[model samples]
Target: MNNTHRQIAVIGGGLSGICSAYFLAAKGYEVAVIERRAHAAEEATFGNSGLLAPGAAMPLTLPGAFATFAGRFQEEPRVLLASGADFKRNRWMRQTRQAQQQRFAANKLRLTRLSAYGQELTRQLQEHYAMEHENSSGVFHLFRTPLEAARMASLQEGAQQCEVKHKTLDTAEIRLLEPAFSSEAALAGALYYPDDIAGNCVLFAKQMRNAAQELGVSFHFSSTVKSIQPEFGGRVALELESPHLDSRLTTDGVVLAAGMQTAELLRPLDTPLPMRALQSYSALVPVKNPDDAPNMALFDDSYKVAMTRLGNRIRITGLLGFMPPSQAIPPKALRNLLKIAGDYYPNAANYNQAHFWSSTIPILPNGMPLFGPTRHGNVFVNVGHGVTGWAAAVGSARVLADMVAGEKSAVDTEGFLPQDLAA
Candidate 1:
């Protein structure tokens, strides 16, 4: 290790990468960010559902998740099981099912702590910089059927055990929360984490990048990562190929956060990171009437869709899991989204000019990120955030940075460490 002058290289310049770079630079380490995209936040960080939800601590493979998976198969343009026999898809389901057992109870406890700590980190960032990314509080989950409502009540109990605050409401209360919902299907609701917020992930990343740059963090956009070579004494040599030229760079340590491509990059390194590149779609539609837009974020339990209002733009993002990325937005998924939107908020019917966006969620079977140091002396991993990547980015970055620096973190990261999942 270079004691006098330490150079750190981070691959992938999305939210996780940027957050890692920001914290490293703040700690006075020389930082270099190598991004393949023409711009930052161009991949998974682009146009997300925009929920900075801290209460999203429930594991995706809860006991009742099998039931939800059954629901997923029935829905067209489905959000689960992209394609059967897809190596990644099969592995994810198998691993996810395995994680549902009691042996992994500690994992869920750690996840809850990390998520809660993440919420505090987000609050501090907002206050420290006064960023403008549509940070709205008040998140509600609406259920259409009694069974659906009952399912949520059970999940709420789990959430409560995690120390997340929530309240159950009847049909009239649901109406007060979002009067636009006229369908008799919406009979009950749950509102929790009044402080849980929403915002554009891309916007927040850009803002953080700007701040990081001011602190002397160097960002190399449009540079594609070609290879990573293990150098002498816990150092790394990075080969980068760009449109302009091919070049090699060296650093004391490396952080891999290349989203779905991370698995491909590390394959040759003999690190089997089993991950599912679950594809998800989102649309930003022009709002014809301001009244029709939701003032707060709402999760439609029946449809597995999340809707939020970003000023004049109403963003609806859902539909996860799929094989070959859909060439374009699936019509069935889009129609279902609009239908749900209209069902909950009648004014949303006036929505027009919807722009479709899709991203590959790097899903781990445990539904938690394979975050923290790898077996390699100088290498670290920070991808596989799944749907909660946006929510966990900043906090996880802080945790990973602390591990690289050999410091103890405020939150317990034992279960989230890469070695635990590698087992």
Candidate 2:
């Protein structure tokens, strides 16, 4: 298929959409991106932990997950539940529980492969474009107790199967690797992935957008795509609701990469995607002491929190609360994140000057992202990446572009099909 004459429109200007446009343009297609925000990476891609750990890409539905969720009301809880459960939330929980019993291993493998591919593509882009976004290497998974470490046996198995290099380190070894770790804090052991990396997600996205533009991709910011309808000649028409633009635009194909809004857009096309939004929180603080700050990324397994060193700043993020959209940021979630920062690296950053952030992350029940054609012939989707969006975006976009170009994908596209997750 010759893509030189094709015009592709990508919905959403976040990391996924930007990468999609970049790959499509690289294939000799004329690409345009429609973003509701004024600029790229203004939403979920704005503030993330910046972790790109394929070795640590495990499924969320582990054994004894329900037992853990039962402690949502406890002090410094890792997971929070809504006071009132809606039908969508209830259905998501039910499916998640079912997946816990049936799909953990498969989902873990799927995520591991996709994340590994994405990390490679990310490094390729950085080296090829001479782009630097405060890139760092290594990831440490800290466990407070033996039981906490034991729960990751399945993840370790999956890592081995995926050939992801990792090591089980004792407390002394962990402290040697990261001497700034507090000795007073309880610690049993840690899993260290030396090949994993961390970088500034927003900076990387903006740089990639520039690279895409170099390939002749146009970006239409503050342009909201209200609806998508298939045209008579196999093209797709998009209804726009931008203050500065015309009402409609038609293109050869449309890719839906909008987080949370992807499902809403698919509904009018009669494609039902089973996805739920999870509210997550993060805090960015200026590093007060460089020697005391971590050299790489750290994940506290017991608390389900991540602390990442991004240039001169430290981003502490955690908490997956199934709550209402109108609800304010929960005080308990903020306290838990602060507690982790203080417990592990109290002198590393200016805690009082931390900037708090919250965003809704769309996730599938099986903890795997969907990226492929939908029921509509010319419409494709690249959404539901959850918190692993940074780790999986590039690979998903590459695969999406391959599918759209009628070419064979570099990676196996078994469970990533949009119809595989349809309700």
Candidate 3:
């Protein structure tokens, strides 16, 4: 099947959808992106931590992870489980436990490979498009205690097995690399991944959108996809609703990359993906003291918070709350982020001028994204990336494009297909 002439509709305007549109357009496919927001990257992409750390992109369900999180819940209480979060009743939680017990090694390998491949593709795209988005190299994973470092045994082993370039840094080395780190804070050691990167995700998305547009891709901003139905002759019909017009657009295929809304769209097609929407929070503040601000990305292992330098500003993001979507940001999550910011670099940023935000991040049971085709022939999915969506976006998009074109993907496609979750 020659897919060069095929017209594909991508249902999202975030990083994943934009990357998919760009990759598909580059492959000679006629692509049209339908975005609900007036502008791109207004949701998850906008609030992304922007830490492209493939070395740290391990599955959350690693060995002893449950116990570690339990300890954290008892001590600091970073994870918030609201009233409606019934762990036993939630199928996603049940499958996550199963994966933790049985498929940790496999899932970790899959994610590591995809993350590394995504990093490569990101560089290639940046060079080809001559795009710059406040990019910075290297990431430091800081630990506050030896106990916290011990909890990462499985992660370290997995990184070693995957051949990820990393080195253990003592306190002196850590201080040498990040002189701005607060000396009063407790410091055990750090893991330095020199290959990882940090940059502005929204800027990258906009740049990719521009590249896609130059490749003859059409973008329909402020357009909403009301419904997607399979039509005759292997075509898909998208019922669109927008202020300008309401009509049905037909295409050869449909890619559901609408972040949290992807699950809702799949329900009508009888292909229910067991994905949970986890609320993530972030605070973006201007750098008050350049001498005290971080120069690159840093992840606090104890708090599970990521602080990344984006040009003159800093983005501090962390905390996963199992709660329903709301316009109001969780005060507890905000406090945790603020505490991390103050603890790491107290004089680096102005806390009063910080912009607080929250977004619903769709996560799967196995901590891996679902890509490629679904049960429906013309319907595909590229969602459930959790928080690593930014790290894995480009590779996932390339894999999806290869799948649609009936070509082999450069990386292994195992455990990423929608059918892999059927078990």
- Candidate 2 lDDT, tens digit per residue, 1-423? 235439999999999999999999998889999999999998778755688889766555422335446763377665666775467666677788788568777777788888999999999999999997787888888887676676577778878987899888776787898899877777777789999888788888999999999999999998999899997778888999987778999888989999888999999888978778777788899999999998978877666577889879899875677766544678877787888899989899999898887877787887778899998868989987755457788899999999888899878888889767643
Candidate 1 per-residue lDDT, tens place, 1-423, comes to 233446788898998899888887887888888898888888888746777775644454422335545664355433544434555455567677788555345565566667777778877876799887676777777665565566564556556776777777665775676665454554555555566677777888899898789879888888988878887667788888866644988779888988877777777788778776767777778777666566778776555577877877778875564546766766666676676677667666355567776787777777776677676767777886654456677788988777777777887786677788756
Candidate 3's residue-wise lDDT over 1-423, tens digit each? 346438999999988999999888878889999999999988778767787878767564322235534665443455656755475435556677788668876777788788888988888888988998788888888877786676466666777876888888876776698898777777777788888898887898899999989999888989999888998778888899976655988889989999878999989999988877778788999999999998978887666678999878999986677777788887777777888789878999988898988888887778788898998977999987655457787789999999899888988988999998876
Candidate 3 — number of clashing residue pairs?
A: 0
Estimate the overall C-alpha local distance difference test score of candidate 3: 0.80
TM-score of 3: 0.92
RMSD, candidate 1, Å:
3.0
Q: Top lDDT: which candidate number?
A: 2
Each candidate's lDDT (Cα)? 0.71, 0.81, 0.80
The TM-score of predicted model 1 comes to 0.89
All models, RMSD in angstroms: 3.0, 2.3, 2.6
| Model 1 misplaced stretches (Cα beyond 4 Å) | 1-5, 60-88, 101-108, 143-163, 187-189, 243-246
Q: Specify the poorest-scoring 10-residue window by lDDT in model 2.
A: 59-68
TM, every model: 0.89, 0.93, 0.92
Q: Of models 1 and 3, which has the larger TM-score?
A: 3
Q: In candidate 1, which residue pairs get closer than 3 Å at backbone N, Cα or C atoms, i.e. clash? A: 79-320, 82-322, 144-185
